[model samples]
Target: MQSQDVAPRPTPASDPVVDVEQAEAALVEHYPRLVRIAYLVLPPGLGRGRRVMTAHALAQRALPRGRAASPVIPAQANGRDGDPGYAFVRLRVLRAALEAGGKRRGLPKRSQLPPLLPQVWGLKLFPRSGGADELALDQQLSALSGPARAAYVLRGLEKLPDGDVRRILTEAGAADADAALRAADRVPARYELLSSPEFDACSLQARPTDLMRRRQHTKAALAAAVAIAVCGALVALPGDGWGPDGAAAPVYAQNPAAEAALDPGRLVRVTGTAWESAARTDFSAWPARGDLVDDDGLLRRALAVWARPGEKVRLSFTPGTQTGGPAGPPQLLYAGTVDNARVVILYDGLRIARYAEPKDGTAGAALDFARVDGASGAEAAAIVLDRADGNVRYLTAPWVKKAAERDLMKPGAGAMDLTVTDGITSPLASPATRAGACTSWNVLQLTDDTGTHVLSDLGELVPARLTTGRPAKEKDATGSQALHAWAPYACSLGAVRSQGVRSVNAWQFAEQELPDGSGTGDWACTRAETWRGDGSRTLAQFHTPGGAYGAVVAKAEGGPACGPRDPHVLAGVLWKSEGGHWYLLAAGSRDTASIRATGGISGSAQGHVLAVRAKEGAQAELEGTLEDGRSISGLR
Candidate 1:
């Protein structure tokens, strides 16, 4: 068809505009191309099925509301002879696609939702699979930001030059068009792959969703609806029917065990002096002590919510921890008012569940869960009482006679006394909440009859215990030498926040003297062990003689290196001396008989230390021989 075949009638010079009729004509002629643009620019997290539907919806909705002036920009010279109607419709599609992938200032846009008109009922439609090259390009595009992806699509699919792409992006509300172009340049230019079936939303592959799963879901949904109706009727009858569960969800089914769990009277409260004679000292020995311990109403509400939390409750869980309701009546650890909220702590032998509600009402409640199945010793010595204003309060063990705050970065500084009232320590600055440069790390030091132990909060309900020494003979981090060992690597603890860490042990494995006689560098390995008996992280750190903090040379997650199972660890770092020369510095544990470096650089040394002259940015592989004649590879 000719260009003028669908053009609207000529208008006056003072009121030149593209009306709805002209825009619709351009959209109908170039529907496939416009849909491809939207598909490529839409966020990939929505999956291929939704991307196809949204792409079609955006292209169909690209018509102008009425008569609108086209943006004052030169159109690309590819085709259509710079048609104003095509440009107007293209800009609308591009703007809507970008908005769908990002946040807007005012109300949520319609493009963000599943397209209402262009959705399929039982069939899921997605673009056809392409070759490896197309798949790689799709992955690379997915990694780019929305604006960057739009820039790439406009350049490749639309065959527009960089200048046109930049102008179109700016006119479409992109904040930084140059930045988008720069980011697009990082992707390899495989422009031909843009026409592959993998990106063509017009020609799609259709498949029916799992029929069996849908059937099961429909049956479950109907059952739930009936149960909800029954519960609503019972609630309307009043009397003793599920009275005020706070923010908890409505009960769908009636069961004797669940009812018993919701009863506040069934909560196990320990005696104050139980730990003195108990065979095992752990959270089981924690005594019930809170001003609201006698407040039956608050306790009942807390227990009810713990059994069945509602949608309004804010819930958080540590890694690998489950959020299911309690199996039976749980133990009461603490129930009282803290700061602006009424908090309650409960332990069900496997997990520690914390429930908190507002003081004025039950709205805006929060619940948190952390796995503490086999906790004892220092690991079970303290429970977080309250966390507010970047500070934390802990209810220490009954045996803890004194509480103090110490900075792990400043080991030489004396510990500051903190007031302990009813086994609760005053608020201390939490290192997990600190931002920017981590110059200092504060830890809680609790002194009991055994000695002193240190605990650091890792953004969880329970604090992770700190220790230092060899893997076989690890001890509490209270000695001067142990404190010094933990100073340089303390800030590195931020890497393990919210990871359910139970304890962290720092071991100084080796020390090497610099080749240029600059100074001695200490090699230390820190291992963080989680409560789930897995996901242990080990770091090999290098600390120079006069450096403020140690640098992590090598690290491994869930590896046997630096642990008791495999006490031997070897690591290397490329260091530059004050004399302006580069060298490969490597060290192994004390039991190592010799160490060697290969691949890109070669060196061999006796007695667990090796320093070889090398170039900067050179990669090398290390091997070590233990005293028992076993070989070990360097930590990656």
Candidate 2:
């Protein structure tokens, strides 16, 4: 999904979007779940760009909808006076998602949508726990067309009113939620909604048609902003990371297929640890975008894009001997890879956690192959494995099954394919499409000798600009920058982990620049850094771990630390990753040409920089600062 907004939406209904303060309050407490809802509502087939745009746009639109049910209170309405802020925020988000996903064509400019066919494998439901409320809302609803799924999630999972659900679905371009539900067909049996006594009274009256809807929802955009807290987490790794167990280490262990290393050719291996890859940790980044705001109108972690607390997945791997060797970090390494395994991942509620690849070539090496919440804490996760042969495998945690999947303790439905890249598939190529649209969402569910498994059909997960928002202390009703985001389409997994394949060899051998056709090649790299004031004595580094690379130059000057003990008054860096090593074709730095700050001493330099002008995937570690008192570091 290319990231582009639908022409600004007409704010319909009363103002569901509260003043900045209230919107921010809702964002702090419930934004993550709201994002999850938005994710559910987006059709996965959208490119990362499109998915991101639609989700954010929907959120923008949602903030002001269904508000006829509620109006603004005077000043203290930002939940300061005990307003039902959570309910207000969620309804808007749900409305936005439904509307966004309901688009049958791409953007209006897209003219004709390729089609809405998603690939599916019957194995879909991902129930975190065996309990009743443990719904794999995403997976279940994902298999259905966006409109239908939106209906069920709102009415069934969130328990929204029948009227709201009907209006939401219709506004999203569907005839009605019931009709979308019928299109899914499997949902009724999966949720047993039609026969369940619990839903006996959900008889909703149909709203007017979409044409009439357009007439009703014409209004202005929501007013909100996202402010970011730069000092503690953004400027550098969490303060803890700068000191102890918080640093991002490769945790590299030998690939169990050590023998394959001798075989040459492409001996691919998949490995990682808990809550690490395919997840977001730089919460401090993205705030400058002012996309998602909280009650204080600051940019913040909008939501848990992947794992939430408690959602654990226990991964099963081969048992091997333990030996320790120091590569990046030293630990017990696994001996060999597990074979013909029946790995059962477990989940609790919808929060996914736990899940590890038992071995890494060296034995006793219990490394968390991949994680949802970054390093520690359990959260949601989806697994993918790369066979030495070229194809990929998707696995559902023991408890996490697709939504439409029937029969819990048995193989439900699942599917597999090697063509789709970056979790996206165009309907034009799928036989599942109908007329220029899809008759249904196309995520495949598959059942195998190993229980039910789901190949990652990223085609269904909608990507969006993720951030949290809060109002600024100084009330400015007119200050929210309409939120926006961009989708950097991935051509390949490259140095990055498969979003589906939770784990991959940290260093793909010589994937980094190595001793090749090189003469200190052009310095190439993508980067991020920070700085203080006075004489710009600085620090800087380059990043190329994900394969993004380029030759780069840096310079800085300083003044005084903004405040006492605040060594960094001003700091900033920009860089991107690459499939090949980055090259610092040339480089230089200087603090002599500096200035003075608070104590007459130049401000301290605190920035990072790097260069990978190598041919093979290898580069010695380089770390330093830039001109004008900035601190910089390299990210692997």
Indicate which candidate wins on lDDT.
1
Q: Write the per-residue lDDT of candidate 1 for residues 494-585, one digit (tens) a residue.
A: 76776789999999998888888877899999999998889999988888877767777777889788998988899888877778788888
Count of backbone clashes for each model?
Answer: 1, 177
What are the models' TM-scores?
Answer: 0.65, 0.27
lDDT of each: 0.80, 0.28
- Poorest 10 consecutive residues of model 2 by lDDT? 297-306
Model 2 ranges off by over 4 Å = 1-17, 47-57, 60-91, 103-140, 161-164, 167-174, 181-185, 188-636
lDDT agreement of model 1 with the native: 0.80
User: Model 2: per-residue lDDT, tens digit, 519-547?
Assistant: 22222111111111122222121222222
